[model samples]
Target: MEDDKHSLGLRVIHWLMAIFIIGMLCSGLYMKSLPLSNEIKFNIYAIHKACGITILGLIIVRIFFRVFTYVPPLPANFSRFVINISKAVHFGLYSLMVLMPLSGYVMSSASGKQIKYFFHIPLLINQNKDLANTANELHSMLAYFIVLFIILHMLGALKHTFIGKQNIFKRMI
Candidate 1:
């Protein structure tokens, strides 16, 4: 059986994650591009860290929701190859959604930077520069892949809506 749209919980999580991830990406790019003072940059980094932590929590909840919820099947006309590709894209997105925040948290914690939830809760761990550098490199590398996958995902949705007239985008709405 298939439904025309996603559940309310799924839609809520999707939009919330989209907003948070976009904000984190824009802030990260801007922070890297300018010659900002160390203090200012540090402040921005703190905000990013807080957002990342929140995203991490959301992703955890999303995982549970995904396991418990029923996902609609693709249109019957969709070929096996198309279904496989769709699965791959969804898997990639979910993987990055979890990894991106996790890698950031590791980088921050290992680099001796404090990671607090809204500047109130303490989330400190033992410092390890080597681990920090590794996590940072992984996070940096994955960012490009994430962006690429996101664009591809969006294009697929647009194609379904405009070219195929499949109404696939409505499933997520």
Candidate 2:
């Protein structure tokens, strides 16, 4: 198979997104482990919210570039099952990327917290206790799924890089 290349813009955004996501995940786990307190929880939530919004923006730009550019194709020797799994994984990643933040926004809005976007503006949604609770639960649950997906993703990438000896990892870099 030909060595697939990533566009400079895509590569930059991809790495930035990866760093942002990893940071957010760490912050989130830390926040979850902390005791509920106004000062500490509020600060962590603010940072988490900011990161989520930034990720949303970056994801939008990534999608636009993905639609316009030609990403490298999978290796020809790759089996159809492997190809199908890759497609499924990609779909899940994108879907979670979009949904996780939206769920968090809904949860924050429902709890009557000021949804600050990078300290730029405060967003408000209708205050409904039930809705907020539901969103919070969904967000929490999806977070676990996202964490699992990420682990699987990293394992797969490592397999391609070391075991499979494929260019999949290099193409992204």
Candidate 3:
């Protein structure tokens, strides 16, 4: 039987999303590491916010396409445990992708900071300091998990490509 594959557009968007996510993660970590003032931190955060919002938009489109498109199934020989784990990881990734930016936006808005998307329109959410702090904490903690998952994801893809001799990497490329 012929191998099922992702559509070209889906593949392109997938890889682009991956790049944006990595960029956001790196910039976020760097911004956190800096000993800058709140204003400076906010400026850095604006960039992060822009990247994150872009990612959120891309993810929405990806999710829409996923629902409508005919995505290829995983290998039949794949174990149930592996399949379950994959589902859990995918769920986590999607949930975090949606929540992280929303949390950041809430944090900014609550602190009386404007959430600017690049040079585009600003996001103005109602202020709530208590909620903002909670979101901020969740965003920070989830970031560590994102980093770990990304590392594992990369390792898994490499294993599939090098050892399994599968075209798993090509699916996203």
Candidate 4:
């Protein structure tokens, strides 16, 4: 059981990233649907940007931990195809984890909005209308892909936990 589990640091970071990512996705959608003149909408935007930057920092730490830690292997019973799919899903998730926040930062920075880490420290970045638009478009498009990948990841974990009786979820726990 011990051998099958991820390191404590990894598990904690994984869950933290998951929570932030899910929150960001939902808040982002909600903010977009809100009226431009809404005061609460701007507040949500500030919080969203702050959380996005936090996610970016967490992701960097997550990557560093992932590199230096021992990652538990998947169940031995999983077939080659299943393993391949799992790898692909993880790759996609990791990529999006980095890209999503980065795109958001670029969008905010280019739009001439000063980004504050947790609503305090300022991050210096130049504004460019064209770049802002481009980043916004990319960030918007990436949202769908991130959602899809997250669903796939959850489904795969569910399959292993219930159908396969592998109890793979224990690893993260």
User: Top lDDT: which candidate number?
Assistant: 4
> lDDT value for candidate 2?
0.83
lDDT of 1 by residue, 97-151 (tens): 8999889988888887778685653536578999999999999888888888889
Candidate 4 off by > 4 Å: 118-125
What's model 4's lDDT at 23?
Answer: 95
Highest TM-score against the true fold, candidate: 4
Q: Can you tell me which runs of candidate 1 are displaced by over 4 Å?
A: 36-38, 118-125
Q: How close is candidate 1 to the true structure, as a TM-score?
A: 0.92
- C-alpha lDDT values of all predictions: 0.84, 0.83, 0.77, 0.89
lDDT of 4 by residue, 38-149 (tens): 8999999989988988888888988888899989888888899999999999999999989998899888888888776635644456878999999999999999999999
lDDT of 2 by residue, 25-106 (tens): 7888898888886479779898899789888888999888888987878888899998998888877887888898889888
User: For each candidate, C-alpha RMSD in Å?
Assistant: 2.0, 1.9, 2.4, 1.5
Candidates in order, TM-scores: namely 0.92, 0.91, 0.86, 0.94
- For candidate 3, the TM-score is 0.86
**For candidate 1, what's the RMSD?**
2.0
